[model samples]
Target chain A: MTLAAASHGFLSPTGVEIAFVLVGIATLGAALMTVGSRQLVHAALWLVVALGGIAVEYLLLTAEFIAWVQVLIYVGSVVVLLLFGLMLTKAPIGPSPDADSGNRWVALTVAGAAAAALVWVVVDAFRATWIDLDGAAQGSAEAAGRSLFRFWVLPFEALSVLLLAALVGAVALSRRGGGAKGAAETLAPAAREGRL
Target chain B: MHLAYPAVLAVLLFCTGLYGVLARRNAILVLMSVELMLNAVNLNLVAFDVWLRDTLHAGQALTLFTIAVAAAEIGIGLAIVLLVYRNRGSSDIDRLRDLAERPSGPDGAGSADAPRQPQPDTGAEATA
Candidate 1:
């Protein structure tokens, strides 16, 4: 009885493909906006949109596990870090004239050439490949785990060490000139002048 | 299921990032561009994984690692940018030329963070 009404549903392969194309276009637009916006905050927001769009593309590609991971990591943590960086660095919330360099034309030409070459190479290489959307081997958690534990354990552990090192480096770098010695040095000049 | 669709999209996104990295002066903006490029690479990885239909799903697994590494990278990168901003009073890469490129002579020693012209008021000064 419930199956009768579901025959005219929206979850067809054609529907998935359409969503993929639309999301791809939207992602591209958001990516362009991320690079084009003069305001740093706007660029960050645009990055969220672009990253979210990529997550959606992952979903459309039937890699649901990776899609959610993308959301959890990229959208949740990375963008927040970026925002903190922006705030800590005191980036202007408004349009910044200094956001762009004078070498835009040169950069654009180089980027265009790279993009063209990449697209041509990828398209030609994968011209005969087709992914079956309803295949049995879904890129699920189990599959990812199997590969990660069986073949990629060393690299995975190495990444964890790298993360720990990065954490330590961030802490040490940001600590900077923050001790009694630093305070004393600053007060030394004023002390000599009898001001402090 | 044309593989070129996602491939083309990823390429476009990556190139946009490349342009941003090269053309943007702000350090944070360059980091954002780097994130964009990483995202593009992730999309391609997932697409190719699905295309090959591997049982182990190597691409997706590698992508997870990539995302984690990217998070670590941004954390460290932001800390360095903040430190530079605190010391130099500017996040502009052009202004940071002295930080990376050391001068061998004694004459240039005191001019590491010196600006060529008077800089406009950056809000971080009050906080600094």
Candidate 2:
């Protein structure tokens, strides 16, 4: 079974290029807006845009399963949860006063250094590699599912644990408000009283 | 080279997101910026997935997982931010200063009525 050749000109050889360009542009713009927005919820909504872009890219790459997962998880579940959390906790609900803080310079320096280093490493490592530019066939949902459940079982289990821990931690932190003192003082009694 | 286009786009997304993360003090914006960075990484992964043609579609599959994990992060992260706001009456990154690394109050009294002055509410429509 021969994979599609890199220079074959059959895969997305026409107007699809234009569509990819437009989608990429829109995605970047939305991501910028999300990060630049002062409001918390607006930021989350913008994240949906950025995530949507990634999904489109996945589709463009011919990884339909990954694309759908991007939409289902990032755009649908995650952003909605973020909004719910923001609303439930009654955040400023408006422009954040601390959007511009004194330490911005320091953060900029750190983030800049990190990005530069990463880009340099990736470019240097892969600059000379010959790539096919055609997606793998095993990327289908069935194959991916089988591989995930079979070879990557340990990592999958670990991820499940990590997610569970995060969920529990979030609920604990939010519900108790970390209420001024010991966990026992609040959670234990609440549990005994069936209030938690 | 077609790879160059995706590479440039990925780099642009990464740098812009980094700026937002570093320069913006709002917690929500920081989270959004992180999402930007993640998307950049996703772009790179998909580009490589298409170009190098790895078996098992490793790059694309990992990208899917990354997106999923990011969503889960936002869910928990926003919840924590909201809880912080309820307690301190402000979501200012600078104002949340004292609470940094100190998950609970100093004396175990995480009362909403802390002695600090409260900021005025902006009354804008909630973004959610």
RMSD of 2: 8.5
Clashing pairs in model 1, backbone N/Cα/C closer than 3 A: none
Error of 1 at A41 (Å): 0.6
- For model 1 chain A, give the 10-residue run with minimal summed lDDT: A1-10
Name the candidate that leads on TM-score. Answer: 1
lDDT tens digits, residue span B16-83, model 1: 99999999999999999999999888888888888888767778888998899999899889988876
Q: How much DockQ does model 2 earn? A: 0.30
DockQ each: 0.49, 0.30
How many residue pairs clash in each candidate at the backbone level?
A: 0, 5
Give the DockQ of candidate 1.
Answer: 0.49
